[model samples]
Target chain A: MLWNLPGIHVPADPLYPGAPPFLTNTFLLTIVGSILIIALMLFVGRNPKQVPGKLQNLVEWVFEQFLNLCEQVAGPERGRKFFPWVLTIFLFVLFANWWEVIPGIETIGFKSTDTALSPACAHVGSQGFLLFGQYSNCITPFFRPPSTDLNFTIALSIVTVVMTQVYGFVVLGFRLQIGRYLVFNQGIMGFIVGLFELLLEAMRLISLSFRLFGNLFAGDVLLVVISFISIGVGAIPFYFLEIFVGFIQAFVFAFLTLLFFTLGTTPHGHEAHEEEHLAETAHAEHERVASALAGAKLEEAHAQ
Target chain B: MAEHEPHNTQNSRGGGSNPYQGALVAFSLVGQVGLMISLGALLGVFAGLFVDSKLHTTPIATIIGLLLGLAAGIYGVFRLISTFRKAG
Candidate 1:
């Protein structure tokens, strides 16, 4: 079944003495995911062909679909610019999440002698084999899904939010982008609103990170519990669900990133123009009402 | 709006109006709004704690931070809603 939740604790024993304990199972899994992606890319790029092989065809199809999605979300110009980053994120996240469904991912690892579970409670039984002196349920998993880790998700979010700001500055210029955070024109009210905008910007990091971390971690736990309850058959449907969820989450993350990029790159003047248009409409409505009232008053006078 | 016209046309061509995509967009917006509010408050609390520690004002700074956080949360929700509306 499941070991103690990975990344909940920094392993006391380092992979090598004098090394930091931060090299966690999730970190290892992230490395694995990266390697897999690199290998796939290398395989696809090793030989060029006028016509494509199955693998190349699959890769090309994915690329085309994702590029189309980016174009839809961010226009052709920005979409082409953002295509690589968004695609990389989507592929990495999707692969990382799918790693969880691999058999024995969090189940198989070296047993540790420093377990929190008591020896008496850790005996093998009809339910399942229990190894003593290991972490939760006496099993130390070697790899866990990287997306389940907050650090991984947070790093991705930082990249996203930081790049968004960078693009904003590149498109709108520094003063205008910074103006988004430090509004000063409308006196105290504008200043207050600016502070809120600033806070909201900061909160994007948490939002992006927590959404990925929460979903993957919860799914991992759910799978473990389900498997523990019913060993094989019952867990199959859940695995399929996780697979679907993994794809959806990856798409959502990429789509949201594209959306943020589009929003960020848009000049503040556009919003101001919309506001002006709204004001103009309101004024026109007022004028129409006033004219109607005036005509009604003139008719009453003429009747008198 | 002129710039976005091509993008809109592309989306229409690609069947972007599918109910599933609409649901996903809605879900993303709602989740983002919720996270922004909670995290804003949490960040404010941390900021307040740091300020209190530095200034020895204790709960006053924390209370002010909490209020500011609430305002920020509400503003964030409005901004997100407007952004999605504009995008859609």
Candidate 2:
């Protein structure tokens, strides 16, 4: 049945049994997604024009939207600094998620005939292509969505969290950044709060990784089950749903990264500055309102 | 009316009042809470198991770790909510 859950197989080294090797379906898909992004950027940016064509206009519009979002969330100055990273992350994840919806992604692969290889490969008479003398009931997909894999998402999360810390240190200096996780003063409550903050930081890595992995994996599994139950027709609506979900997930991931970037880059001392700024703005607003009310009263008297 | 105008202007300037942005923020917040709690507990159990194995005290450290994890998870939720509130 096509409804079997995706098996978590340790990718074997194609060369030797104990040889240190690399590259799995997830990695390959990631590489492909990256290449696609690079190609799209090159194609859209090849010609500089006063008025952009359709593809160039589309690409530019997307970038402009993301840039605006970053600026809105992170302020204009820091937004510009982090725009490229956010854009790259969004595009990569967007492509990686969307790639699963393409025809023959998880559906096409060779069957495992060698039962000795693994227990999953023990189904001898099952329907699958004969791949390296192995016959299994189900085919191992050539390209799985990268985000559906825990390893891929964890790697991405690690990089993101590490960058956040790096940016924090750069902006706040080593002492202040360390101070964020460790409190030496302010009594026991302060120390406890600091420990909780540290725990939250660790949890961020887990949350970030698992969120992407769970969403994509669930979607992929749902698609497979639907396709199995009703052939192809019933899965069509779900395919569209998955596309929307893919886009939303990509947006959320990128936006959160941008949010963290903003938070990390803000100095601890800026809280007081921000409060003062807000107070000044409020005072100005109050004066403006008072002046407007006075002007309205004067106009009313003149009319009377 | 005068008092409300500054808040309104500030909201408009912040640009986070849009429905799409709101939805994204809400989704992310939900995911954060769910994962924090579950992963926190799971990590705690594993850590406790490792410690218990080393010290030959099985359930004692495990129970303590689980409680600590639950506390941490609750703290995490509050922290996330406050952060979002501040941002908004």
Candidate 3:
């Protein structure tokens, strides 16, 4: 089942040509998805609407949702500024996500070499890869969801992490960004904690990248497994569940990016108002002690 | 969303010229896949443990499955990273 499944090949043909191992059926979907998104947006918003019809209205709604999401997850200030990025990401991701259901990815590709880049054994199966070229020319699945491809998801994740860091610097500045993990005030304790924070910063790159990939890839594998395990009716519910998961995973990725952006840009000590109060109290105590000692000396001199 | 229009025009090389940007994007894609596999392996281990308890064996079976899953996930991550480095 695993060998005959949808994404077993990177070249799907490993040999048909001197193809790179990175190319696969799943990647075909991602490439098409990106194009589809661009095309859809161009077609839908070609004209500015005063009142707006159904498609226009829907596009506007999604746009509004992404903006609000940015504001909610990021502050209103950054949200307004980053709205473009968040919206583009969501739209591109959403399109990539829903593309698999478009009906051509599985049964529509051409019969090439059946490796990771290809699907099903070319010579043995019933017309392997039906819709495109011999090995992934511009002729593969007219549409494959980008998210299904591990490579595509990882690509998206990496960009997202980079964007987050870029925005962090924009808001915090370089010195402040470094200060977030290089504090020297608390002496050795601060140094240790700072090192931990730095490590976490590096870990964020891995964690963010993997979380999205994990969800999307798992969904893809689940669908393949379910389809293979039971075809007539048993797989129906799982398919529906996969649809729900696809949307949720996309939402989670964008939302988390919003979250990381907010957290990353914020100054560290700003949250600890109580510490400032304590310092003020200590200063007042020193002043009171000094005044009392001066008063005592004056009293002793007068008495003498 | 409207802001995207301006940026798109700026980035529209339209010919896949920005190899560096492409490499970063490709690296990210690999990260996500490795993560998914790692997660899947973790879940598999958990499932194996649940079944193992009934069979009177300890967590050995689950641990083995988990280790295998981790190996696969890590292998995927390395593959993606190496590719990114080569392309870069």
Name the candidate that leads on lDDT.
1
Name the top TM-score candidate: 2
Model 2 TM-score (B-chain only): 0.80
lDDT of 3 by residue, A113-228 (tens): 43544533343344433332333321233334566555676677778777877887899899877776788987876675565455444445556655655666666666656765
* lDDT per residue as tens, model 1, A106-133: 7676554433543433443323444422
Error of 1 at A66 (Å): 2.9
Off by over 4 Å in 1: A1-19, A45-57, A120-136, A269-271, A274-304, B1-19, B45-63
What tens-digit string does per-residue lDDT give for candidate 2 at A1-304?
3343334443321222233345667777889999999998987788768999888878887787777677666776777888999999999999989988999886665554444444556664454344322232345566778888778888888999899998888777898788767887767766776776677777878777778887888898888778766866999999999999999889888887887777666654345468769999999999999999999999999999
Residue A10 displacement (Å), model 2: 8.3
Query: What are the candidates' interface root-mean-square deviations?
Result: 2.9, 3.6, 14.4
What residue pairs are clashing in model 1? none
lDDT of each: 0.76, 0.74, 0.59
Task: Looking at model 1, give its docking quality level.
Answer: acceptable
Question: Between 2 and 3, whose lDDT is larger?
Answer: 2
Candidate 1 achieves a global lDDT of: 0.76
